[model samples]
Target: MSVYTTVSRDSLQQWLQGYALGQLIDFQGIAAGITNTNYFVTTTHGRYVLTLFETLRLDELPYYLSLMSHLARHGVACPAPIADHSDRFASLLAGKPACLVSCLTGTDVSHPTAAQCRAVGEMLAQMHKAGATFPRKMHNPRGPHWWSLTAQQLYPQLPTDIAETLAEEIHFQDGHRFDHLPSGVIHADLFRDNVLLDGDSISGFIDFYYACNDILLYDIAIAVNDWARRDDGELDDELARAFLAGYQSERPLSQAERDCWPVMLRAAALRFWVSRLQDLYQPISGELTYTKDPAAFRQLLLAHRCRSEFWLG
Candidate 1:
């Protein structure tokens, strides 16, 4: 979460008056993510997070807010959006679409242990099951179609080999249809930074802006790619196995999902690679932002291409 919009103390206090959150004691900008303006807000009532939408529209926010509420109610560990005096989840802060959510209790662990990976895996599977009955039907915005378009957009700016690799992968993914696989609302960007941990147990999952309806295996692949990776960008077999085990403890994977795991791994890699490339080439300025390296995901994609069998084993 990055800060694109700045809210003044007086203005923030005035806004806080609209809610029963007591007076705003302190707030600070969060600079770890690339999407949305986020701040750690503290009040006499409790701690919370204030987020201003940087790219999401006002009309398109209900799905995310409602989904979070649904998952939280269903025993998923996630931040629940707080409504205002008018009982509205979305509001305007610094003239941008904004909302507040309860501040999660833990901190993010970058280099997680095997047990931590298991916790995240279990939580993710529970999230998918809880969201299965959610009424919203938003598609994955960074799925294959977006990957194709983004690859084309970035091709001219990249080296020949990188561009060719991206184009080829896009073509291959387009030809492969895993639509029949188990589909549900997925935390599409369940990277290390998006999950919070309280001493090896998952405290909460944050940053649901990228959440959408997608293949369940694809979501697992995304998490595994991030949480079950070694320093060299290769999958850590023990961690991966533990994570899969935890997920299966909740909802077992189908034979079809198993067959498509390798491709789904590559698909997840390609999605992040394209998005990082886009951010690298076409960046939006924010008050506080963190732009990740595109080459990291490029290396990850190549590693997945070469070592597809490693994960399945």
Candidate 2:
């Protein structure tokens, strides 16, 4: 969920049968996400996920659904978009684009271990490598350019002291001082909750709403910032080593990839920091949505800047 989507049971049922798929046996709202609302929809054939898009354009949804179908067809471990009887991937429901996706099997990991971090890194590396050939182009919403725009809109709403500092960071990015990073389709946001696990092994990844074209190293940095960092806002070397080693086992990082890790991680920190602050101050006014603390990543960015090598190793 992107903080702006909602789902209704009646509309879900209507869309399911209207698409000529089948009767929806049962559907319930999934409370774990903060962006678009989701439901685990069960039917006679099988269980599928129904997502009500909140932020994306209706025209852009085909790219998302098509990309999922393509990734699943290519053996990438993710929830594939389930097509309707007409082989249409999407249907208009209550004036919103709603689609069904194949349900991935696994439990979401709330507190991941080092081994899990390594597995996440491995799977994500494979995703990036495979996604290089994914046949669609979607611009990442949290890329530097978008970040600058977000800073402009949200900076004033932040606590007075941090606003100027964030604006300076935005100015620095605008100067083109941090623009030399390889570009590709990236997950952009891969928090531990997004990675599913069965026992000690990773089963699949979910929540592709943030997927887009951006620096590949920045993608890794997003995962590292989320998975390989300790609760005290310090990068865990053991976790980072495990993650990087597992990722390298799939696709080796270029020298450029390695050299850019620190700034990329810092950029990732800034990305989440800005987003979390936006959500914190401008929470969605709705039935059931909670705000996340921006301070988590605020402290994270401070620590990373103060001790760059903490994330370097």
Which number leads on TM-score? Answer: 1
lDDT of 2 by residue, 101-195 (tens): 88878888766777888888888887887887888898776677777877888866777778976876666556544356667778877888888
Q: Report the lDDT of model 2 for residue 85.
A: 74
Score each candidate by Cα lDDT. 0.86, 0.75
Segments of candidate 1 deviating more than 4 angstroms: 282-289, 308-313
TM-scores of the candidates in the order shown: 0.92, 0.86
Shift of residue 123 alpha carbon in model 1, Å: 0.4
**lDDT for residue 309 in candidate 1, whole number 0-100:** 56
